[model samples]
Target: MKPQSMLFTIYGEYVRHYGSEIWIGSLTKLMGEFGLSEPAVRAAISRMLRQGWLESRKVGNRSYYSVSERGKKRLEEAAARIYKVETDVWDGKWCIASYNIPEERRALRDQLRKELGWMGFGMLTTSTWISPNNLSDRVKELTEAHEITEYVEIFTSEHMGWSNPKQLVQKCWDIDEINEKYKSFIDAYREEYEQLSAKMSNGEAVPDSHCFVEKTKLVHQYRKFLFIDPDLPQELLPELWLGKEADELFQNYYQLLNPGAVRFFETVYEAAPSA
Candidate 1:
């Protein structure tokens, strides 16, 4: 994993729960477990700091880092979706965004496209995007952040076209491809889950370090779905969707690893003079 992405997973899964701060030394030591060098960790931290995703303080000549408010809000939103078991009923209303950024600001326009996709908006046309989720605040935030509010229009409306809702979904997203990705995830983790479950049942003593690594990798892998999965409501999903099954497996596997992982993390976190 890239050091920056790994750091995000670490902060979201571990540091946020324990005072939401860590000494640079503790952070580096923990990251070392994932084969990240101190320099790489430091560089990643610098980028996140510049991006307003992290804040730093000094205590006794040592630097400390914590997620910024923006980072915390982002992590919380991510966690809610990552661990969500039930999809909320769709309101049947669509949140749509349309933009006509000037060609001179092509870079900004491209960035807006990426951000919209990350926010789970699928392209309905060259300049228009749509999602079933209510995203008035998020839409406002992104457009204002990009200083393109005047160039964009936001709307909420029900489908009134000839195509059915599922057809609209098809035109906007590759549901088949998404389902295949979910299948791959289940295939990769199912056996591991079964083995771990058996080990715990047999009173086998698993190593804390192992748990830490497994949980971190599990979360890192699962979190990727946030970008790829628009998290559509059940009404828009296929009858045999694998997303729910994958979520169930993730939750079970995570719970099984939680105690050991937390213990390992705390052991490392408290190892510094003051973390």
Candidate 2:
């Protein structure tokens, strides 16, 4: 992970759990949890403080720190960027499911696999189903959209023993119980996407800094709906989806504006061509 990203994640955890009052030791502990070295942790903290994301008080030999309002806002935004929700429950019909994803949605398929893993989908064999969830409506939509229906199949009950009990214990992917936890997040994302689309159509500039901050918050909150992949090399498939969604939404909005602006902004933002 990028140092800045790691720093924000650590800072967010501290603020969320301990409020604004945090000690260096607690921060250090979080760093260890994330497998970061002490020096890297300190550097991230220093950078965050310098950026006005954290405020520190010096007393004796120790410096106590807490997230400033600016820091809090940034952390919230980062959380939105980093977190997402799963919309389905695994019925445990399979141990690992495989899908022959379309080229157009390769990224999306990769993202779904990562998310399914995060939600407890295991891989007994590549592209084979192994989640404990019964297929849900949302999952169906996602799979269909990615055109992987034929490639997917439920595993028989006999496949259960294939899972490594130790690994399963360590990484739980049961996400059915948390469906309600994602309602607000899904609503917020849809609302933001719609509003941003409108604003772009009206030729309004992408809101002010404060509004941008709020948008970022919504983006972070929006992530709670997607599944994450634990087995994937990078655990950011959800983040990648958000970026792609944002780019698509922006392009749609831009096209509604003056024609010339579309190419201009696309070049500046370096957006992928719309699918």
Candidate 3:
């Protein structure tokens, strides 16, 4: 994960409990467990400030950093996807969008496509995108945000011909590739989950260092699904979706880690030397 992305996980996941502010001292010490150097963390913070994703305040020569309002909104949206589990009953409808952008504004075109993908849209053609989810509001938000109102057309449609929507699923996305990732993620964390679960069940306390490291790794792994999974409805997904199984394991393990993670985080902040 990028240093900045990991910072987001830190701030979004735990720092919010402390009024969304982290002293540079506290942040650097915390990030060390994730193998981030102080200089790297500072550099990432500088970049985030310039990008309007972070804000800072100074108190007697000491600095505290927090997510900017814009970044806070982004983190909240990301959290919705990262933590939510739903058996969305597919309405058998699709939100389709077609757009044309000037070649000169290739950057904007790329931004549009990327945002759509993040919103779980997939390509039907170079110009058209589709999602089983009702993304009309999200697409409109994108158009307005990008100021590309005139370049886009959106419609919601249902299957009407002999061809099945299921047939198009594979072309729009690599379900096989997604499933493999689910398998790998599950395998990677299986033993960790078992041990954590056992510890929690036995009411055994976890070490602060271990808790910090495990929590970071768990959030990092779970956050990846926000980018990789389109979160298609059950009807459109393969039977016995490993993604569902993975979610169960993720949630089950995370619940066990949460208390210890919070304890470790709180203690770390409390240990920071006051300016």
Candidate 4:
């Protein structure tokens, strides 16, 4: 990961759990896990501050930063989607969105398409996208935001084609590619879970820095699936879905790593100084 991305990755995992406000010095020390120098880290903070993602304050001679309200809201909304375990149900319906944008507005059309894809809409054609999820309100908001309300329409309907639904899902989404990422997450963290399990069994201590780094990397890597994978319901998935197995591993391994990870973080960012 790039140094700046690494900083926000750490903040999302550590700073959110440890506290809202982070001391600049402590943040620098915590970022040592990523081997980022102070200058690069400082540049990241500066960029975040200018982008209205962070607010800065001074405490005695030290600087502290907190996520801006805008940033906090963004994180909370994203977390809701990223860590969600499963859809309530498939509902046996697909939301179809059809749009007609002027050629002069190709950029806006492309942006709308990108956002639709992110919102779980899969392309059925250049001008149409579909999803098993109910997303009428979301599509309305997008069109309204672009002042193109007249250009788009959505319908909720079931796929009636005899083409095996499983095959259709494959054509719409690169499930195999997404499955590989989940597998990658499993391969990387399964060993960490085993080692941590052994340590806990023997009452061995895990270093704060090691715990912090490992947890951050694990979360960062797993979080990428939010953008690429739609978290489709089980009925739509292939049998023996690796995503399901990978999610089980994620939940299990994350629990194993939490104790030492929290212990280490408390020292770097949350601990009170000794009297």
lDDT by residue for model 1 over 22-123, one digit each (tens)? Answer: 889889998999899999999999999999999998877988899999999889989988877677788899999999999999999999998888889899
Runs in model 3 deviating more than 4 A are 199-205, 270-275
Order by TM-score, highest first:
1, 3, 4, 2
Q: Report the number of backbone clashes for model 4.
A: 0
Model 4, range 1-275, lDDT digits (tens) per residue? 77666766766776766556788888888777778889988999999999788888875687888888866765675577767776676788888899999999999999999888878878888899988888888888779978998889989988899766678788788888888878877787778788887987899977766766777777777777767887677789887678777777777777777777878878778432221
lDDT of each: 0.91, 0.49, 0.85, 0.79
Ranking by lDDT: 1, 3, 4, 2
Q: What TM-score do all the candidates reach, one by one?
A: 0.95, 0.31, 0.92, 0.82
Best by lDDT: 1
What total of clashing residue pairs does each candidate reach? 0, 36, 0, 0
What tens-digit string does per-residue lDDT give for candidate 3 at 1-275?
67888888898888876777788998999899888999999999999999889998887788888778888877888888888867679999999989999998899999999889888888989999999988898789889988998999989999686658778887788889989999999999989889777876798867867877787788887888777688898889877579988988888877777777888888778422343
Among the numbered candidates, top TM-score falls to: 1
Against the correct fold, how does model 4 do in TM-score?
A: 0.82
The local lDDT score (0 to 100) that residue 26 gets in candidate 3 is 85
Better of 1 and 3 by lDDT: 1
- lDDT of model 2, residue 106: 73
**Which parts of model 4 have CA positions greater than 4 angstroms off?**
17-19, 49-52, 55-64, 102-107, 142-150, 270-275
Clashing pairs in 1: none
